[model samples]
Target: LATGDMGIANTTPAACLVAAFTGRPPEEVTGRGTGIDDATFERKVRVVREGLSLHRPDPSDPLGVLAAVGGLEHAALAGVILAGAAERVPVVLDGVNADAAALVAVALAPAARGYVVAGHRSVEPGAGAALSHLGLRPLLDLGMRLGEGTGALLAVPTVRAAAAVLRDMATFEEAGIER
Candidate 1:
C-alpha cells in the first residue's frame, strides 16, 4: 500500500494543487496548517495564492501540476501509488498529504483509485475535507495528526485481519458445528 510523508508547509502546495484542479478559491482549499498564528496564516495563504497564480496548472497535464505546486514527498508518493496500481496492489493512504497526492495520482490515472484505501482520519484541518472530496471514508478516527505514514501503518493490521477472516476462517457447516 502507498503511504505519504508530510512536513510543514506541505499543506500549502496541496491546497494550491487542489485549487488548480478543482477550480476552488485558494481560501476554500487553504487551512491553518500546523496551527499557525493569524499573521503566519495570512502569509501562508498569500504564498499559496502566489504559487497558484504562477503555476496556473494545466488540468490536462498531471505532471505539470506536480512540477508546479507539488512537494517532493507528494510527487514521490504519487509515483508510488501509480506504480502500485500498475502492479495491481492496493495503496492505503495516510492523511491529508497522502490524500492530496492520491488526488493528483487519480487525476492522472483514474484506474488508480481502485487500488487505494483511505486508512484514517487526520486532525489536520484540510484532511477531512480532502477525504470527502475523494469520496473516501477512513477506517479509523483516532484524531491522529502525525503524517509520517503513521495512520496507514496503524490500520494495516486490522485490514490484514479482516482479509484473513474472509479467506481463512471456516464456516460452521465446514467445521461440523451447529450455527
Candidate 2:
C-alpha cells in the first residue's frame, strides 16, 4: 500500500498522514523508502514532521484521517478493503503502509476485519502497532517490507490452500480413519 514515494517527500499525502497519526518525529517512524541517501532521508523525515504540523489525524474518525493525510493509493486501498468486506472476501494485508491503511479501513468498518488477514510481519515497527490494534496475526514472518501487495500476493496461495483444506478436507470421523 504505502510503498515507494510517488511525489516529493514534503508534498506527499502519505507522509503527512503517517506523521499526524504517529505524532513521532520522522526519524522515529521514517525509513529510506527505496534506499535514498542520508540527505534525502533526512529531508523525508523533516517533511513528514512538517506535514504532521499541517494536518492532525483523529484515529476515531478513520475517513477524516485518510482525507487529512492519506494519498490516492491509501484511499484506493481503503476502497478495496471495504469492497472485500461487502462481498464477503478475505483481504490479505501486505506490509507497513498496508498496516496503516488497514487501520483506517478497520476504523471505518470494524466488521471488515472479519474478512481480513495479515499476510506477513513487516520490518516497520508501526506495522506491528497496526496489527496489534486490529488483533491480527500474520501467517508469515519473513521480516519483509515489500509493498505493492507483493507480500500479500506471496501469501495468497497459502491462504487459498488453507481455505481449501478447511472447506474440503475430511476429518478422521468422516474419513473413517484412526485418530
Model 1, 101: alpha-carbon shift in Å? Answer: 0.8
Q: Model 1, 82-101: lDDT tens per residue?
A: 99899998888887788888
How many residue-pair clashes does candidate 2 contain?
0
Off by over 4 Å in 2: 1-26, 177-179
lDDT of each candidate versus the true structure: 0.82, 0.69
Tell me which residue pairs clash in candidate 1: none
Residue ranges of candidate 1 with Cα displaced over 4 Å: 169-179
Q: What is the lDDT of residue 52 in candidate 2?
A: 66
- The candidate maximizing lDDT is 1
- Summed backbone clashes in each candidate are 0, 0
Per-candidate TM-score against the hidden true structure: 0.86, 0.79
lDDT of 1 at 11: 83
